[model samples]
Target: MSGADFIDARAQGRHDWARTLGTVALTVAGVAVVLVPTRLLVLPWLQANGADMPEPLRSGLLALMAGLIFTGAMAGLFLGVRLLHGRSVRSLVTTAPRLRWGQTLLGFGLSGLLVGGLGWLLDPGAVKPLAEVDPRILGFSAMAMLVGFSIQAPAEEVVFRGYLLQVARRVFRSGAAAVVLSVALFTLAHLGYGLESALFSLTSAIGLTVCVLLLGGLEFAMGAHVANNLVVAFLFQDLSDANAPSAAGVDWTELAANIVVMGVLVATAAVLARRRVSP
Candidate 1:
């Protein structure tokens, strides 16, 4: 059950292209509909009312709100795979002969270690000293963010690599094409963050897609993404500056470094995935 086999199996079946495309439309629309309650409505409410609360508590509230919103999309990915493609939900998850949860968890640990370490080494400015966080609040805030990222990471992986990659392959007939198209689409999904974030996202999408393609599933991508988010949101919790948009601009140096880091992640995952399948 290689990715190729999964794609071919779906393509050979009696499924309508229009219906598959409809699934894509529905999923994206669902995200927008969901954001109305989770982000659009709630974010302003938080800004107005949450300011009086402890900063850590405010942050934790936002994180929990985001997690619930993203989890909805993750569930949609499952339904989309089954109802639209007439394929098992598991097939879109992994093309490996069997699901490998151990390897997936390993991917999470490896990515968290490597990305967190490398980000600190390359840009000393990327992280603040842990001493800055109040010991009382840090533990709770971190837990809240961890829950948020856990749901957010798999949402992106499942939609971009798991669902759309399969569609891209059927339509384009090339893995490279699927990867490129999916990366571009994923970048567009970040349009609200402005150009820099949109472009920066492309690097990550490419890296994760490469990992998914090589590892025969989205597990490595999901793990890597979740860990990456934690590193940025936690370790990089700062004395100054933030990933939160203050202005719109692209930093080429930062973007290039991101690409290099992502490439390393994909290469590492490939090696690990290989070891797991070896006789």
Candidate 2:
């Protein structure tokens, strides 16, 4: 089936305004359930006692907690799909009976290569060397980042590109409308980072949405998102550092590079999709 047809067929039946609203509400509550307690209780406790802990250990713990919020979101989405929509969680991932791991891996490798290479070429100093890190803490921090982003990235994809996109397409009965709405929402989700950051997110969301429509699945988008974040976090920035600079703005050059990288990713997805359909 075509990607649009797959989305339409998957979203067919059982989708109504009420269920859609319920799913969104549940997702919010799910995030809150993890976020609220972490902010009010866990964070305070960590601040009080974390000073004595090793920096790497403390940072890893924080990453773990942050990652758990997405766990809650995924949980809520699965429950809502099962109960309200009477569909399996797998339906949100792909039209196929099983996930296309090869596509996902290809996306991860390609995006990581493009983003990491671009960042390195732009500012070689930005790349953190593993040898410079404290060997004792390196394993802990690396593992924590891997685990955290593994959940965090895929959860965002499941929520935005998978559920939201499919439902929006069904409701609007226009793939274009669905892509625009989902891209807007996705961009808004990053607005707190600043206009430049939001614009970058807009570019990324558009590319990812295109991947979903072309490949008829979330696997490629999920992998690409994960790789992009990992490349930024592990190489360019220290996520364990609370005082690390936010993505407030980027220079024109960086913005141009981001656009190019996104374009390449979308083009790659298009090529792959074409091959899949070709005899």
Candidate 3:
């Protein structure tokens, strides 16, 4: 069989071509729609005109704007596919999510340890202050952060791995191509982070992209992304400055550790997937 034929065979029952195409179209439309109202109109308007706006108001507005953008993108993909491509809304909602919850949680725990543990190692002082927070406040923060990150991270996975990667796999006929595209876009989405941050994000995306492709699911990647961000937003207090091993840059030791941990987790997931496929 030809390469396209091979890929088509593999993805045959998994996704509908028309639906994937519709999702791509809507995702692009969502980007165009959100830019004007959210980015141009609200952000600058608030900063320039709302000098009296409290810090909380400013932060809340920004978060709302970001959430809107995220929601728009997801709606475009999910709704666009259903409306334009005539796909089932239920299937669209759950596409590309062959979740192995156990493996996914393992991946999350492993990556968290690597990332968080390294920060502790490189600067032993890093872990000290984390324990100083009030238990009640920390508990609230952890719950809030996890809920927020869960929304954002899964939407990201659906857009990139579930939608973009599937279409790319159809066109390129290689999982690697889909992975590369996904990783590049993933990094680009965080470009506001500057050079170092972007570099670190790119490295992180590669590791994640590989996990998604090899395991043929977004669950593990979603778990790892959420866990990593949660640690930064909740558990950790002080962060290193921009230059010396900041959040953006993945340390060599930790990066290696993530590879091992994520590798094992994905490998186990792949084995489970194979068993599921077997007669």
- Which candidate's lDDT is highest? 2
Query: Per-candidate TM vs. native?
Result: 0.82, 0.89, 0.67
Between prediction 1 and prediction 3, the one with superior lDDT is 1
**Model 3, runs deviating above 4 Å:** 1-22, 28-68, 87-99, 127-136, 193-195, 237-279
For candidate 3, list the clashing residue pairs, or say none: none
Score candidate 1 by lDDT. Answer: 0.71
Best by TM-score: 2
- The global Cα lDDT (0 to 1) of model 2 is 0.80
- Candidate 1 clashes between residue pairs 3 or more apart in a chain or in different chains: none
Model 1 residue 271 lDDT? 85
Q: Write the per-residue lDDT of candidate 1 for residues 56-81, one digit (tens) a residue.
A: 55666666776787766666655666
TM-score of 2: 0.89
How large an RMSD does model 2 have?
Answer: 2.6
Best-to-worst order by TM-score is 2, 1, 3
RMSD of 3: 5.9
> What are the Cα lDDT values of the candidates?
0.71, 0.80, 0.59
